[model samples]
Target: MQFIDLKTQYARIEPELKVRIQAVLEHGQFILGPEVQELEARLAEFVGVRHCIGMSSGTDALLAAMMALEIGRGDEVITTPFTFIATAETIALLGARPVFVDIDPVTYNLDPAKIEAAITGRTRAILPVSLYGQCADMDAINAIAARHRLPVIEDAAQSFGASYRGRRSCALSRIGCTSFFPAKPLGAYGDAGACFTDDDALAQALREIRNHGQDRRYHHLRLGLNARLDTLQAAILLAKMEIFPEEVESRARIGARYTELFQARGALGTDVGGAPVLTPYVHPHNLSVYAQYTLQVEDREAVAAKLGEQGIPTAVHYPIPVSEQPVFHGGLLGADYPVSAAVARRVLSLPMHPYLDEATQERIVAAVAKAAGL
Candidate 1:
């Protein structure tokens, strides 16, 4: 069984995908092509934002957003440590410090309560990651940023179609960056990303930054990186968007089934009424796209091994926290983020996708319960 079932998704859109790619080929506008602009416009409209700048990759999108905001040397950006390294890597790349914040144990997102304590005079931005297809608490984060006159960049790589308080993920902050990697909820065929914002001036800066800081032909306005999105990827995304809304609904239906099945076991004593395995928490005010159906199991290794034995694939979203990474852990001790450290040792991800069928999910869930010896 495939972990993400990309093959099924590909088959569903194969005809459209072929036509879109062929169109790009026929036009021969590979870079900054008509498709790119069209895609940016569509993405902006979808996110309820004024502008969307297509980028080379998710990492480039983050880098370009930070560059557009001019976050560099001696500046600090507060973020959670229990996420992919790219969230913090881009900050350090610009010679800025990534101030680590502990995650909300329930949401696995940056805890807003700890954010104000981390902010200081050097703080330039607050980068909150919307992990596992759910939007972070952007309202609180934005209030803090507003008080400090700092920008808020939502790392929305895992959450494209997610919504928070009726607002879309990429439209919830000063600048929201999302990925088009194949596994993301809304993805392209290859590497691609986008930066969304309501500010026109910042959008202009980002457009220039993606094209090597060009304000005009051969005019270098600032130091920048080549981060343009390929026209082919844009075309693929435009096709995918046609079915993206229903796909998100499918994910929610499947996710709800998984939650019900796991909660019915009633073996785990941690949550009083829930099962032993702790399923993901989607706030009442938000909608998650179920990028991954993750569980916090006491014996993660045992559960994963058992799933493998049953021919069910399982993965670990993250086994190490970003704060513990060697490149950035110079002064941070392992105990600093106690929650991140403990959560890292227990998280496991099961096969999740919009096409997942109920019978297959039941089989997978039964395998997990048996694996845990429940």
Candidate 2:
């Protein structure tokens, strides 16, 4: 089976998608066209934010947010090391440091309790990644940021429809960034993303930053990158948005069902090679869009091989911690992040998508159970 099954999703939205693309082609306003503004407005409204700046990619979205905040040379940005490279790459690109923090073993998110100790005079921002479609402890993170008088940027690349304490992911922080990479819950045909905020000044700065720091046509204000989202991607996203709300609901439901199926076969706390198979944990009052329903299992390689033999595709969201990356040269590895290190070894992401069928899910779960020797 296809890992994400985007073909089915495309088939469902084909008619509307074609129409949207046709309209964009006819308008001939390819860059930052009317559809882009409409998309920005709709996305902002959905996130309950005052402004949404469409960007070239999720990486650029983070870069723009950092530029708007003036997080630059010699500054340090606190974040977890157990996420995608872009989460830390953006900080380093701005000539800043990415301070690594350990993750919560259960949720696999940056543990808020460990954040305060990482802050120092050089700390400029707290970038928390909402890994696996679930938001980090934003309430605690925000409170800590407020106490330190620092801005919080939610690297919401994996979470667009997720919610924490009744608020959306992009609206939970001072600046929020999300990706529209084809695999994301809401994605464009090509690379695209957005930065969201309620702060007018930051919003305006981000807008300028996305267009070579332009104040108006042909006017450059500050050193900025050309990070604007193309109109074709905007139109495609607008079309995808038509069914995004329902798709979000379907994903959550499918996630819950996966948990139930696993539990029935003795997943959690079930002995597999003298170790328990740990399922993902959703914090109370938090609603995840369930981008990747991952599990912590022993003998991950063996289990993955078996799953592959059964025609079930599995992936590891992150196999290496950013701290251990070659470029970091183990500079951030002085302190042991046992949880991040351990999770990296055991985590396996099963096929997950909003349109996943129950029968297919059952087959996939059964294969995993057999592989785990349950």
Candidate 3:
């Protein structure tokens, strides 16, 4: 019944987490501790990247990557609007324009066909978000970037463990960033994030940027922010990493089961398959970590209310497109971003986690079916 069973996950890793934390306490290197480097190393290896620079949060990771890339005023970063605000906020923060692109209705990711048209002479990078744990069309995006000689920054906040065409999410672009927010698929106990890249110079620049642009002790190389990941969070992430692979596999299994159940009901035109509900889509060359088991449902507010009445928790990943947000109002208007607008009105997320039990899942499905009046 819980939306994301963190308690069960905590129970599973309690002993290891305790031990990891105790080690951090004993070491007493609270900031930029050995544990942080250890975590970065493990994460980099996992992602098949040459370097991973840990930071305070995913937003900071994005900002740091932009800073390292020298993205500045008048520079434009093309991205989809059907995602969390952080994806666009970071670009705006650097005084760069976030060129909004429509999404693929089925995948809820940036539509590559729509990307080239958004590109202008000011375009410096392609910032594609891997929404809800599935990667966008990286190959297509990369092809466009290559043609323009632009860097690609993969906003992998919700897709830490996802794979695209045999490559990991965070290792697919010039620089990739992911969050360790507790709600993310692969998360630490608190705010933490990492930037991944194979380019040594960019990696070096990111390390300096995360540490206030210091090339050496007190020698400021460039303007930067104090974005270092804390020792405690690093320890927690290390503990979580021990079992993350298994958890990802478990999540895939759960997703497959949900797909089977929903597709069966959908084919039968049952309540769950009624006009209100549309299942998520997974690409053939990619694997989703199922960070959010989302559905496209009609009258989302009413469906959510009905599910709430049944004691089944449901939430929206995003209710408004980032382009329409108050902060970015009118910035992307007249862009004809039809798919992003449509997705914002309909997306609903159900309880999803590796620890989700079968009985609880069935109850959730039943409640949804009844709510949809299938």
lDDT of each: 0.89, 0.92, 0.89
On the 0 to 100 scale, the lDDT of residue 16 in model 1 is 91
Model 3, 287-359: lDDT tens per residue?
Answer: 8999999987778899899999888888898988888888997764447677778878888899999988788
Model 2 TM-score, all chains together:
0.97
User: Ten consecutive residues with minimal summed lDDT in candidate 3?
Assistant: 267-276
Q: List residue ranges in candidate 1 displaced over 4 A.
A: 267-277, 332-335
The candidate 1 region of ten consecutive residues with least summed lDDT is 268-277
Clashes of each: 1, 0, 1
Sort all candidates by lDDT, best to worst.
Answer: 2, 1, 3
Task: Mark the regions of model 3 whose C-alpha exceeds 4 Å error after superposition.
Answer: 267-277, 332-334
Pitting candidate 2 against candidate 3, the one with the higher lDDT is: 2
Q: Estimate each model's TM-score.
A: 0.96, 0.97, 0.96
Q: Tell me which of candidates 1 and 2 scores higher on TM-score.
A: 2
Comparing candidate 2 with candidate 3, which one achieves the higher TM-score? 2
True-vs-predicted CA distance for residue 203, candidate 3, Å:
0.3
